[model samples]
Target chain A: MASGIAFGVVYLVYQPFNAWITEVFKGPALPVTIVTFIFCIVVSLLTPPSTHTEEERVALVMAERNQEKTASVR
Target chain B: MVSGQYAVLFVIGFFVYIGLMILIAYMTSKKGTTQGEDYLMGGRNVGLLLLICTAAATAVGTGTSVGATANGFRDGWLGAVYPLANAIGLVTVAFCFSHVRKHKFRTLCEELQFYYDGSPYMRKFMSVVIFIVSIVWVGSAINGGANYLAYLIGMDMIPAKIITVLAFGVYVFVGGYMAVVWTDAIQAVLLFGGFVTIAILAIPAAGGFDNIRAAYEAAGNPGAMTAFGVGSKGVLGVLAVALASYYGAMAGPTAHMRVYTAKSPQTARKAILIAAAVVGCFSILPAIVGMSGFTIASNTGAESVLANPDFTFAYMATTVFPPAIGLVCLIAGLSAIMSSADSDAIAGVTTFLTDVYALIFKKPVEDKDIPKYSRIILVIMLVGAFGMTIFANDIMSYINNVIGSFTPGMAVALLVGRFWKRTT
Candidate 1:
């Protein structure tokens, strides 16, 4: 969010920063997305894991089993 | 007198094709369950054939017809990289996420909700993002279609834009998902056949590959004949263009909509794989056609083709082919544009109703009213996109770079959210 606003909104539009950004990153869109994905990981690591992790695992198992059952029934 | 006669024939063929599509939409509505799951996801019983056709048809749209042709005109074979990258996305979906059909997900938003441990924030955010992407995509498709029409028919832009919208909108309005799939199935054959035919004819018409090469060499663009766009666009430029298209394909909502509608996970996987194979096989056809257009324009100084290279396919089809073949090929190009436009338009309408409309209205729409509201929103969405298309002279710049600016954020989020456990 910050990088999107900073680069896509603010930095890329301004002259010196935009020129500097071009010198470094070439185009900001793809690089900023990579940055955003890293932020997802880094921010998540810095925060607590969701409590529903185990339930989510079971939900996948259930989905597989339900699919199998549906296949068999059909 | 000869060209005028063909022009009249082209007009008649165009109306007949559009009328046929609308008729197919009406027929499908009369027979099928146009309510609830059926309306949205084609009753969740789409088989391999329907899925393959719809998936391929949607993937091969505006980009292949207009934008990639423009890219090919400018960058040579770098345009082939796009369909190839899109094929990779389709293959990845087949292997990695086809099982999502088993979950019976309707929107990518719902898929996000499932992936993010029922988190509402990502879903809500994705709704807004997908909605915007949908509108932008439809706008781009309309832009391409309208330009192609205006150039070929010699009509003013606004009326051409309206016809472009109605070409797909009326059917999608009446018949919903099945209408899109069935019409797309028929169009898939035409688009593929037409593209391949034009490419084959265009090479000889441009005085053969050797002549094209000589023309480019003489014109000082020997690089446009190269394999990877390495000579024309630097390695970094190629990589950047390829990357922008790739992730967008992996997370494209219309493709996911196909997955959701497939009869089973296995069926979805197979359909997507086949579509990938089909798209991969046809990747280079646009390059041939576009390069042919470039050759013709460069040699003859066709003012219109030179002025707007986005109309490369149009110029090639209408001017290069015989009258009857040209009409068929032009309809095929229209098929490519309409296939994607209608699917994206439907995807946008679905996102709006499920996410934004529900959030504001305090209740899910009654199943019966889905079609009604979908029609209303569909009009509003197309009109909004029509406004965007009129000001844009170049389809590739607005549709490609403009869409490139916004879509990657949500695409990356979806990839991470599903693949990584720490999304929350």
Candidate 2:
């Protein structure tokens, strides 16, 4: 959330690039929309997925096994 | 061309919208049994598409089209930048989603009460304050509906206001959150269709790039072409607008609550990210509309553009489009107004009845009771909101003031609760 808030604060300083791009395209409908759409697709891909990994799963199983083995000894 | 036809069409459109809402309410609801969670949060099964659609629809409302456009017309692109600020706030909410959802809390007020258990009294006080703030916010939304109906139908504002409040209140009271969400989904589509169509047509209406450039020069605001405008005043002024927009976004309770109501942290994150992208696009509509008005009215003596910036979108639609398209746009505006109002009202009432009442009364409230009492509370609050709207001045300004006063404190506290070491 702070990252998003910070983004807003920083955008004020960096928005010249957005304006420049808009002006560069000179208001053509297709290019701007297509470019923005593709950028969004890339960003979506870049966003970190929340699922866990196989190594982490193995570590958790090993920890469980160790706990059970200790419990049996106790 | 006649006044009666507009009124008749509006009435027909209103009923059609209500019928669709009723159908949604009856269809989506689980068979003969719904708990508080089901009614308020849609059983937490909201998929990525539904969540994104609802968020985008809720954010892109009549206020954005009307007030944002007016602000854009008066102040240039800076005003339109507020939606971007809101997108940033939503992204922030997305980051906090996992923490809040994993805890399994039902509402933000509940989260507040839990976090502030150090002072139970403070929790109650803040809960009441949150309730009042939401009421005030929803009240202004109700007024937006009335204001639009009055303008579109050429009726007195009071009658339109009453009709709007009553219409939304009935649909919401009967249907519950299922109704509100699905209705919002439909309304969002309408709003998107109207605005996108207008924007596409407006590219030409703006006379393409050359005409826009010529218009900017004619308006004697070269900075309007560049990123830095004369209004920057200093670093503080530049930051102030950005901060204000960001603050406004954070202050919005409706979007904040959606994070909790979503089915999963992943779904919520995806929704927020999608909303950011879609709302970013929708944000440009008002700028386009306002600029189109600025361009077309340059020679047409249409001072309404300047006199009431709030009416710029409507003015552009009615003046530029065919009668059918214009009416569709009007209905679209009404969709924006009612969707926001109804959803906010449902959320406000649910918070009050379930969160506030349960906390104060010291009872384990059953899920079965929430839908009924929530509807009752919704009516009572809508009545109170209606009274306020009739007497309130400048709905947008009032909303901004409400956000400015309350949002900073809430944001600071919530941020601390989520990220600070002490809480964890």
Candidate 3:
């Protein structure tokens, strides 16, 4: 949801921002760079940090492997 | 027509390149056993550099080189929009989904299964969709490569397509993902070096930037000098294509699969950022080269190549440089096509072996059998792609339609599932 919203905002702002930057700065890089930076910042802030960690992921895999082993034994 | 000497150089250069790739595959395969996981996912132990190379190589396809330059020739600076969008999308992926590297997911279907709370139906559906997308992607790459070959060497398109598909397929069949990544790294370098050299050379040949600008203005297309290319699609249309292309690629099966091979989440993030920077810089080259082509065409009354923008890159390479050097540029463009084709071929086969075959049989493939099965599947996919190429008349339109229809929804799903807890 947050990602979708951030994408929406970037999409909305990019055109006008692009036009303004082209008009003022007379270059394509500055406008794209600025807008991309803004978009990344927005997305980073809005999206939640991942809850799954390496240790937990490893444990999950181990547990599944063990279950598979036991089932095969049966 | 390519001079006989140039054509011989092209043939030798192409064959030698393909032979080197196969040799790499042979050498790499000898280092380890070809278990399915090892073959398909690089043993899930890819370091940062290889990750960056494979990701960038896969992302910057023939479209970025040939098609992008073509668009630049036709639309001026507006041609940069697609690559710019792709760079932003890569950055977004790095920020939003880098953590995916921590998980042991293999295919987008597996990711979708997790996102949808272990729903088998979602996995099945996505597997089919991604598989189809992979096929189309492979076909498009082959089509692009063959077109370049036809234009450069004056070979018939059908034989060129066959040779293109077969050349890449041999390496992947022999070495699998390892071959794909290692060759991708080489191709990425070739691709960037070739295009940048062309851009640099073409600028002076086209009579400098001022002449190119004057030529564009004189062409009398509205917004020719502007960034958005006459605003034909308006702001919304441009934004839509940009966003759609970027996010769709992010959500693509090949892109997602790269995350699984990263050694660490941080490595994946860094690799994606590197790829973004590379792509962002590369986005301008094609437009510049194309615009230069436009200028030359205008001055020399060579409007036929201008009429068909697809030929701009090849035409410029042949015209602006000496025969020997132009052949190098053509090979570099061919590298762009091969890099993407090999990656998609692997992705398609992986999806088939993991998603379709495993699901149908209700059993995971044994490690010992993975390489054999993967090789068989790779050949089948190549044959399918070759068949599809017969009908692929317009490469860009086919690619755009596929990306437009599939990528946005997948991107949304991937984002929502990764960040939101209640996605299911």
Candidate 4:
């Protein structure tokens, strides 16, 4: 959700300051298309991983199974 | 008159498209589990060739070709910029495809939901928006086919509207993703063949490339000679902007969905790269055709510029080329139109089924329910599209506007999700 909020702010900022961005940036001026394109690339780079690490996922499953075994033994 | 020749081409192309559609449905129907996932997403096993052809066919629709032709007509070679933007987007997707498909998520909303799971409500919200946008996309697609039939047969649009809706409903309803992908592959080849043929015939008729080049100079549309010729006031500047815009929006729903459909991430990426090259390479044909229109108009002093840009390509083919070649051009135009609409209709319905029904309902909508619901939504969307076709006199305007508005936000979403590892 922080990412969404961050993007919302960025959207507003980009809209107002879009004309100045291309000039401020190194390459072509921030024509709407270029700015939006760069924005997508930058945000995609920021997105978090969707899945758990293999070690972590396996560890959690193993732990739960062991607890079940212990309970059965008792 | 070229009318008789165009009729022959239409009959031939129509039957050819129909035959290929049936063949694909038969071949892939055996792939097992015609569920929501398999039917809509090609069972997540799409290979490089099918992915490339489907992406290119869907993205480079009649809107792209016809609009570019019109742009070429009004502004010289300046129209090619749109396809260039589209190509850039395709290449960007090629690079991003592997990472996106890594998650094994069925829908793009799932990708978003993965990252923003903290706000469960937000995930639901975004999914709804995405689903609606996908549905809206069906409008332009059906309109494209309806418009094409009107141009080719000189028939009233009522019959054409029925044809567009029913054809989309029937084939897409039965075949699903496998059908959309394989048929699009065949259609893309025909589209390329048709466009290239018209362009080759037009060059000589316009007194060869040299004469065509001379006509641009004569009209004082000199920028048409340059790579940046597609935009008038901001040529090179617009090209750069368009390239960046293309990169951001390259993997919009249709292309992004294909990423998930691919056999593997590598397959997805390779397909996108190939599609990028294909779109860039084939884009020149319509520009050539547009220039031919300008040349013919210059010599004949005809005012053929109508309310839509698609007419520029159609007019040039039927008017300038010999009857046979002209027929080929119509076939190509129809191929591009139908290929795009069919794939889009399938994708749109898939999104509706997966994103809205499956997700929001928060229950497993049995495997058998998928094809049934998909066909139902497809029929509904096509009916809606028929309405849009009737109202949309300037279909190109809506085409450009819709892309301009929807894609940038989605691009931002994709960027943050892919690079930041936000989902972790």
Model 3 chain B: which ten-residue window has the lowest total lDDT? B396-405
Q: TM-score, each model?
A: 0.90, 0.78, 0.84, 0.80
Of the two candidates 1 and 2, the one with more favorable DockQ, higher being better, is 1
CA-lDDT, candidates in order? 0.78, 0.62, 0.75, 0.65
**Of candidates 4 and 3, the better by lDDT:** 3
Give the clash count for model 4: 24
Query: In TM-score terms, which candidate is top?
Result: 1
Question: Which lDDT tens digits does candidate 1 get at residues B113-148?
Answer: 667666555566777767877888888888778877
Q: List pairs with backbone clashes in candidate 3.
A: none
Write the candidate numbers in order of decreasing lDDT.
Answer: 1, 3, 4, 2
- Candidate 1 global lDDT: 0.78
CAPRI class assigned to model 2: incorrect
* Candidate 4 residue lDDT tens string, B312-402: 7777767777767776677677767777777667766766665566455655445667777877887787777676667763663444344
DockQ each candidate and list the results.
Answer: 0.20, 0.02, 0.05, 0.12
* Candidates 2 and 3 compared by lDDT, better number: 3
- Among the numbered candidates, top DockQ falls to 1
Q: Which stretches of candidate 2 lie over 4 Å from their true place?
A: A1-74, B1-11, B29-36, B114-122, B228-238, B391-402
Predicted complex 1: DockQ: 0.20
Cα lDDT of model 2 by residue, B12-128, tens digit: 876787677767766655443245656666676667777787787777755566776765666556546656666777777776644455445555665554443222343455567
